[model samples]
Target chain A: MTASGTPASTGPASVPHLDVDPFDMAFFADPYPTHQRLREAGPVVYLDRWNVYGVARYAEVHAVLNDPATFCSSRGVGLSDFKKETPWRPPSLILEADPPAHTRTRAVLSKVLSPTVMKQVRDRFAAAAEERVDALLDQRSFDAITDLAEAYPLSIFPDALGLKPEGREHLIPYASVVFNAFGPPNELRQQAIARSSPHQAYVAEQCQRDNLAPGGFGACIHAQADAGAITATEAPLLVRSLLSAGLDTTVNGIGAAVYCLARFPEQWQRLRDDLTLARNAFEEAVRFESPVQTFFRTTTREVELSGATIGEGEKVLMFLAAANRDPRRWDQPDSYDITRRTSGHVGFGSGIHMCVGQLVARLEGEVMLTALARRIARIEITGEPKRRFNNTLRGLDSLPVTITPA
Target chain B: MPAITFIHPDGKSEHVETSGGESVMQAATRHGLDGILAECGGNAMCATCHVYVDESWLARLPAVAGDEDALLDGTAAERLPNSRLSCQINITPELDGLVLKLPERQV
Candidate 1:
């Protein structure tokens, strides 16, 4: 039955309700158990605190993402309905937009970040990875998050985006604001906005065409605008989209891969045995520990999802991380096996709105892990790993680890 | 049902039948066929599902344009005259006997 026709007994009142605050700090630390509960609860559950519908199972999440016409992004991929509330900043052109507006901007960004462009930057990225690994291996032990994960992306990405390096540290806290603003106005969200306010101007300035270096991704975006593909006004917003969405995700993704290999020594052994598995290992890590977790989509109209009827304009939270671990779709879903075929995993999401910068992220992960795998024989956890708390991103703040040279 | 033959890098071939309208990438992935990544989920954004159409059947497919044309240049395998992103080629009755040669690697 179509959602337009209300299925008896599947009304809002009958929907399974969860009392848990998904944005709570405790929940962010270990979301797996809660994810399990959400998956088991039902396909569409009511989050009483937020008054939003949540879809956790793989089939349901996949269905919601694929049917973009129903579960649209233009209304804002967060708690705030763009149709009702004014966005804190200008809404993202690509991330928060539906087609054909998304189509034009996406075409410009995708071509700019195309694999051909990635190939040109590869050697530079590889050298950076090697040098970073050399320095870290010399230490033998260090916090992987600060020293490796966060350090590696920060070293290459900003320069690649063609931003001036002076105020580059603003990228992370700024990313925290971008992702956190997607959740309810909790302490984390407020703190992120406050902490990042100081550096917002620097970020905005970097997105300008004149500020970007020639031949870099940012410059390429502006070039597209000059070519009439995208407008001059749309160009900087696209560049800003890159700055806001790009950095922190890659940092967290790299961190997740390292943390996974350290925790799963056997997986590390497999990667060490075949350094070529570095790319696949990184892909598996993304699937195992999805960094960009839940993204909310507002329903364009009434929709019947997994037997539940969702009203028009209702908020539907898609648990992408939870879907990655849904057993209904994957065998031994919780295990981190690098050899596993993780192609279909929603680590970078699915459908038209899938992560546009994934190729870049993969290259970053591949080179870093490949360099480490070639030189480091073992990755041992040296101390307690401190998890970084963000409303949408899941990763470590500090992951202490000791590496043994091969 | 239209049958699609997938020729692996090793020359091993497998035929999968599916209803019309889904892209070849969708059919290949659904049947768990080897070597079709469809990494960007059939958006023509990623060229991981690159395949070489059988020489005789190349003309049956639609002319590649836009994103598909751009991404094809960066496929892991050498881009042949018959090279196409499988995601752009929709399954149809005319493609019932279509044959696609899979690339050696899709990264």
Candidate 2:
């Protein structure tokens, strides 16, 4: 399409448009080849399938994320604009919010998940990792996704949130549905919405202040409301934010780390050589496998980016997975080297909207990898890996691996 | 451009020049100086970019506000009265020759 609202003062330029559906299952299965083409197409390319602008290159994506005022997050971080279409659930106080409201909620959540609190949970999380690794050593082969990736977070995260034991099974489904809903109104989104009632009910019930056990993250959030830091009405929504954002992301993140290590034996060896590299190894996996792949930002006004002028109120789909692997930003962008400098990767996103629960995720990843690094001599892929296709997340459904004890 | 000095825990110092509007953490990381991780990329969410503003220059720097205040409590280094997240301090003409002491470690 011709650049529609170009001002007379600026030179006429055609916006690069592509015939691709990013939300399609085929594209989700292997997005990198398409991602490379998108990156090469331009800094900003219009996706004809979704009728939205797509940003694939690192420089543009980083700039868009950083300038939240210009490319706002409030209008639903998905295809459906919150202003135009009603949200399926109450908007997340922090994730879907901009400043002022966001600043207040973020302060409370950040305090709850601060480094000091992480320090307190460190020993207990480490003990849990050690216990799980001890049990896994007995099995010759196992599904990393089910046994290690899913099981570890399922065990620890809920307890940390003080969620009751009975309805814990709904956490993953709830998170999966929440993440999938971020995409278009495709079958995946429809099916997830249709099946989301029970999971939604359970998550909402668990988020209540009375339902949560004392001296936990959930309780801490409610306490923040009690102390006048946030309103009582906002407390449960913040907990809902955590439940929605936390579990499945970490599960896939751990799965991605294990899958990457299993594929790259040399990188695994490096971690084994220097146990200190456990954190770096997990981080590199995040950079290489960017699990929470894409997020949408709405342009607050007419914007000029990469010589294309995007009209006001247009949705710009950020290819976070593509940016993480963009050759312009990363050296050997496709390789899974554990020792690479992974600090700025947008896997956890960037700017003020960066993942609030990242420290918790990092602690989990580092602890699990360290536990395995200490005992496992090698990680061998024994069977075909099953891919879990989703609109927003890139992860595995099952990864069969056999571990050798050191 | 404003010149800034980053003094490591060992007392060794590195001097760098940064353009206006960039944060001290941005300058350090851009110059490839060690210690300031800036994990949150200047959002002040992570305290890995903690630094102790040199006593002489502390009063001149802008006061800490918002997330930077809460995050200072979580720094790997001890939070001194003069402590700051380098990401919060923007470089300017008046702040030339700013001195910042790097912490012992940044986790």
TM-score winner: 1
Per candidate, native contacts kept equal: 0.47, 0.44
Please give the lDDT score at residue A211 for candidate 2: 90
Tens digits of per-residue lDDT, candidate 2, A30-117, equal 8889999999998888888888999999999999999998899899998989999999888888999999778899889989998778
Model 1 Cα shift for residue B37 (angstroms): 2.6
Worst 10 contiguous positions by lDDT, candidate 1 chain A:
A1-10
- Score chain A of each prediction against the true chain A by TM-score and list the results: 0.97, 0.97
Q: What is the DockQ of each candidate?
A: 0.59, 0.55
State each model's CA lDDT, in order: 0.89, 0.89
Tens digits of lDDT, candidate 1, A282-376: 99999999999999999998778877888899999999999999999999998999988787788898888989999999999999999999999
- Candidate 2: Cα lDDT at A396: 97
lDDT of 2 at A264: 87
